[model samples]
Target: MTKQELKEYYWIRRNITKSEQRLIELETAATKITAQLKNKHDAIMGQGNTSDKVGNTVADMELVRDEMTEQIKRSYAVLAKLEKAIEELPAREGYLIRSRYIELLSWEQIAVDMNYSWKQIHRIHAEALHQLQ
Candidate 1:
């Protein structure tokens, strides 16, 4: 993989996390909307039509939910591919890549965890990227 492709692992992971969070938020909103709609229906039962508003809201939410779900699926596919590639590397290389991208660890933290000097960690990271290619 090129550097850009390798770098995308971090983005894909981030997107997955954000998408999942958004899904939770959407679910909460949907529940609240449902409750509100029920109350509105009871209040305005024969006075006016609520179907249009309810239909529009439900359609919009479903569109957003479907889009987010697809994004999450695609992100997971990329993440799985990246993870498999990382797993194929040597132990140290795999660790470096996983730590930096998947675990979102800082270089210093990775160096400390790996018991290597900062400069040495960079060197290892370079080698890991090369192996990834």
Candidate 2:
């Protein structure tokens, strides 16, 4: 994996998290809309008019939620591959890679966690990237 490929791992993980949140929001909105549709049906029954608008809105939300679900699955697949590559590295390199990319930890935090100086952390990060490649 090149630097860009490693960076992609981070972005993919972030996208998955965002997509999941959006999915939850979509589901909540759909539930609210369904509830409104039910109330409208009860109040407007036999009026010769139905809530086609609300129905369509719920359908659109479902479509978007399904698309987001598929995208999240694909992102997880890619992330798993990237993680496997990182796991193949030596223990220190793997830890450094996971800390920086997967966990989104700052370099200083990683240095503190590993009990290394800032400069030393950078050096290890460089070596870890090389190993990934």
Candidate 3:
């Protein structure tokens, strides 16, 4: 592959990780918002000390949650595309890509898992990228 194409491949591989983190962030925020809405709903209605604004807040949080869900879906699409590229590599190369990037393993860890020396594993990694290129 050309240098630019190789760089794009690497970028896509890394981008999946970034997208996953973003999905997690969206999910966590939605969870927090859901909890806050529930708490406010209970406190307002249960105490018979209700505020109209609390209802508004609940509606707002629901809207936020919906938007977050859409963003999470888009992030998954990005992940799927990256995984497709990785899958195109030879089996061993694919495994290396998945382990190193998707699973976020260290080079030493990958070497251990593959039952190969660290230097050999690094060599294989380079070869894998070359094949894609």
Candidate 4:
């Protein structure tokens, strides 16, 4: 790979990892929000003072939702960087490497999509990675 291509690949890899982490964080926050909402719903379902206590739960849920939204926005930023890097990749290797490695497609899947045998795909992928060094 040319120095520019290598730099692109490095940034793409970093962006992909960052996006994945952001997604994970979003998932975690969403889970917590869901649980909190569910508990709040259950509390409201119960008779008496339980319904009054829901204000705090609702506040917490909103905070979690806001956090998840921010994470999703940051994730989109990372995705934009990754997309630009992918566009800069060499014609011979960029698309395949970005789709397979950055997007996390399986070798067999990439082969089928690319109209190559799995073995050939593996070889080409190996060569692509080697060129980045």
Candidate 5:
């Protein structure tokens, strides 16, 4: 692969990974909020409920919600960076990298489609990183 291809591949991989991780983090936060909500419901049903407990749960859920919103914003930022990086990549490399990384294709599939050896694809990806720097 060419240096341009390598750079495109690296940037695409980075963005995809970042976006995916952010999504996971967002999900985790949502899960925590759900758990807190359930706890709050239980607390309400139970005797000896206090305003302090309810207020604390609401606050925690709000904090988690806010954090999830932030994570979503981060995901959008990653996507934007990915878009800019794609635009900067050489045409051929951009197509291949986007197809393989963003679309999440396996190396064998990308190789077969591109008529490139696996080693060649790896080299292209590596060189792309070097060229990027």
Candidate 6:
């Protein structure tokens, strides 16, 4: 792969991590909303006007949850493709790609982990991209 292609892959991988985080946040929100709706459903008696408002709120939250679920599915699919592409690379290069992108590690952190200078890691990354093509 060209350097630019490899850079694109790296960005896509990074996006997967970000999307995964967003998925978690969305799911959490959905769960909270579900709980609130459940509580409101159970208390169906005194608060008549409040119940109508809660009904509308629950419907809106359900729509948001459905949208988030679809987004999470798409993110997973993209991440899978990027992962499969990196799987063909040599061990060191693949590790570097995963660390920097999928794992979302900083260059300094990756260098520390691999016991190499950050500059050397970048050099290796550039070389690795050639093999990817």
Best by TM-score: 1
Question: Which pairs of residues collide in candidate 1?
Answer: 1-133
Model 5 TM-score (2 dp): 0.53
Candidate 3: list runs displaced more than 4 Å: 1-51
Model 6, 46-89: lDDT tens per residue? 76777777667767766776776777677667657667878988
Better of 2 and 6 by lDDT: 2
Off by over 4 Å in 5: 1-49, 117-127
* Best model number under lDDT: 2
Provide the lowest-lDDT 10-residue window in model 2: 42-51
lDDT of 2: 0.86
lDDT of 4 by residue, 1-133 (tens): 4335533544555765675676667567657766775777866667666645555555665676567567656656665765565566576567678767556677778888888998888788677666555
> What is the TM-score of each predicted model, taking all chains together?
0.79, 0.77, 0.58, 0.46, 0.53, 0.56
Worst 10 residues of 4 by lDDT: 1-10
Ranking by TM-score: 1, 2, 3, 6, 5, 4
State residue 74's C-alpha deviation in candidate 3, in Å.
1.4
Question: What is the number of residue pairs that collide in model 2?
Answer: 0
User: What are the runs in model 2 whose C-alpha is more than 4 Å off?
Assistant: 45-50, 105-124
Error of 2 at 81 (Å): 1.3
Q: How well does model 1 score by local distance difference test?
A: 0.84
lDDT of 3 by residue, 33-129 (tens): 6677677775766665354555555566567657756665765676676667778989998898778766768999999999999999988888887
- lDDT agreement of model 6 with the native: 0.74
Q: Could you give the C-alpha RMSD of every candidate to the true structure, in order shown?
A: 2.4, 2.6, 6.4, 8.3, 6.7, 4.8
Could you tell me which 10 consecutive residues in candidate 3 have the lowest summed lDDT?
1-10
Assess candidate 3 and give its TM-score to the true structure.
0.58
Off by over 4 Å in 1: 39-45
